[model samples]
Target: MSREYKNVISQIFKYLAISLVFMVFGFFVGQRFIPQEYIYYANRIIAILGVLFVLLAIFSRKRIIPSRFSMNYVYLFTFIDGILMYPLFQYYLYDLGIGLFVSIVLGTAVLFGVLSMVSSRKSGGYYLGLGNILFAGLVGLLVLGLINIFFGGARFNLVISAISLLIFTGYILYDISLIKYSVENRFIKDKNDLSIHVLNLYLDFINILLNLLNIASYLDD
Candidate 1:
């Protein structure tokens, strides 16, 4: 592997490891320590803060803030994202049961590992057309999800979960492959570029994990 590739790989793994820690913390807080009302309200606040951090990262990159603020934006968003994983996993643990939750986590980890390895072996990003198709599917999935929230049935949700699972799996492959291409092609402008890459991979993994868990829970029901 090239030095830059190794650097990015290390950064990705580092954040991933931090992700596990926050998820465990979230699980613990939700299961044991947090009271019902606080659990309800805290998530709302955290959700808003998460959005702000994302915006901060966006604006920082656009140079709305000083150049020195760049890494801070990335760091804050990354940390917040890790904390966000906790509440998410906690909710899943409660709804899905510990056994199923463990199964899904293991399954997601294996799937992500395989995808990352496969992506690393490739030379360039897949065609832009694939990304367009995947994104279109994602937008459709969101519309369906919003509709399902109101008017859909169990079967509809199951279908949505299945489709989301597949979409994110494709996303994982696309993202990892893109990471390789960008690095090899000298597209990484700075550390912030790697930060954004890690965030993308992190989101992809989390989405796939939740989608699989949702599918599993529906099947169990």
Candidate 2:
């Protein structure tokens, strides 16, 4: 591999590793230290902060903030994301029981690993062109999710979960393709670019896992 490609790859992996650590720390803090009474309040506060961080990252990408500070945005968001994961994780952990929860998690991990490998291949570029389609799917999924929230049907919720699972599964390939393309073309000129790539992959993985958990929970029920 070219030196540029190698450097970008290394940085991406480093940032992802650190993001995972931050998330794990947040998860542990939420699960073990935060009291039940405050969980609701904490989630609300953290969620607002998360939106602010996301906007900051978007602004940085758009050159509103210095690109060098993008790493901070990515780290902060990931840490907050871990806290977000806690409630969902806890719900599934209890609702699905330990065995099913573990099974779904393992399944998601395996799927993520396989998709990453596929995205690393020569044909990875094919997925790079799928951003628009995948994004449209996500938007549709959100609409359906909001509708399901109001209408409230088990089958409808399951359908939303399944669709989300597919959309995010596509996102995994799309995002990895983006990383590869940007790295190879030297489009990753600053920390903002790097952070965006890492965050995309991280979000893709998290969504896929959550969707899998949701689907599995519905099936188990």
Predicted candidate 2 versus true structure: per-residue lDDT over 41-82, tens digit per residue: 432332343334334433433456553456778788888878
Cα RMSD to native, each candidate?
5.1, 4.5
- TM-score of model 1 (CA atoms): 0.74
Scored by CA lDDT, what does every candidate get? 0.64, 0.68
Question: Candidate 1 local accuracy as lDDT?
Answer: 0.64
- The estimated TM-scores of all candidates read 0.74, 0.79
Tens-place lDDT digits, model 1, residues 1-221:
57788787777678666655665555554456444444444324333433343344334334564433244454455555545545555555677889988888899999999988877777677533467777777667766766665566667766876887787788777777777788789887676666666656666676677668667756777
